[model samples]
Target: MVRGKTQMRRIENATSRQVTFSKRRNGLLKKAFELSVLCDAELALIIFSSRGKLYEFSSSSMQATVGRYLRHTRSDQSHHLDQPLPHQHDLQAVQNEAASLLKEIESVEVSKRKLLGESLGTSSYEELQQLEQQLERSLSHIRARKHEVYREQIEQLKEKYDVEEERQQSPTQIQLAEVSPNYGESSSISDVETDLFIGPPKSRSK
Candidate 1:
């Protein structure tokens, strides 16, 4: 029959618990010794009983094994001595970048306020001069833009005037052209003579 799996909980009876501890402790020590012998490995084990008694085993001198372990741990720690911890460096770099960004934001805000003509009480002479220069440049650009717009408007008006003038003169030019061919004809001359009148005969009598 298959054996049942052993329950791992604490044995309730004190005697049974003590017995179990003795059996397990001895079994663990024997296994450690066998493992070291078979693999030619260095090993150590230590156990303490509830009554303050000690059980221990080692493949070599206990002191030597402990000293080797301490040295290994120390070497591991020393290997990283030349560089700062990752977390510390990352946090410090983040703080510095944040501070830099904050300063930049503040500078932009101050410049914006100056442009809007606010918060000028604490401005130095140099700062005020810079602000004045900036404003002058902006005004110059605005004037240049205004002049360009005015020139465009004038050009448009001139074009419109030319077009209207051409429209008004076209009919008169056609009429003059049509009458020019008959200017010196006899009929035209007779019509002009008939339209003319002499002084009245009463004037001659007077």
Candidate 2:
């Protein structure tokens, strides 16, 4: 039977305990040495037996390895000491800037909503001024276009009126012949009455 297979707490027999300790210690050291030889890495091992005997190993000089560890610790501490810490004023300034940016974004959103006609409530003086300016510009453009259209319509009506008046004043062929020849003539009296009463078709429509 293998000794490793037999599960027992620390061997009660003193001789067996000593033998096991020696065997395990030699195995541990051998494995450590093998690891150091196989890998080109700095390695250290320190062991103290129950009898207060010391055992140590290093891939390089033990003193040099310890000095290198100490130097690494000192460098880390020095780096931490040299770093600048944030002051209260710096932190407060950053917070204030963040708050101001948030307020500006909110103001822009509110103004956008107001312009889209989603809200119907009181507004600040500045917002009201912006709206008033927009309205004034729009009203000015509308008034200008209305004036142009009114002038065009007025010109067209005036031309129509002039045409109608001229037609009414002009004479018919029978009347023209009568005016030219004033004898006891071929111009019928009924035709003269019609020319007077029925002025012109264009004039009546107007």
Q: Pick the candidate with the highest TM-score.
A: 1
* Runs with alpha carbons beyond 4 Å of true place in candidate 1: 80-206
Pairs that collide, model 1: none
Please provide, for model 1 over 77-134, each residue's C-alpha lDDT reduced to its tens digit, 9 standing for 90 to 100: 8998898899999999999999999999999998899899999999999999999999
Would you estimate the TM-scores of all the predictions? 0.38, 0.32
What lDDT does candidate 2 reach at residue 177?
A: 72
Model 1 TM-score relative to the real fold: 0.38
- Candidate 2 lDDT trough over 10 residues, lowest sum: 188-197
Q: Total clashes, candidate 1? A: 0
Query: For model 2, what is the error of residue 27's alpha carbon versus the real structure, in angstroms, after optimal superposition?
Result: 1.1
Q: What's the CA RMSD for each of the models? A: 20.8, 25.4
lDDT of 2 by residue, 1-206 (tens): 65557665768888887788789888988888888899876777788876889888888888988889899999988987766566866988999999999999998897778767656388878877888798789889999999999999999999999999877774686588767676546456436534344668898667
Candidate 2 clash pair list = none
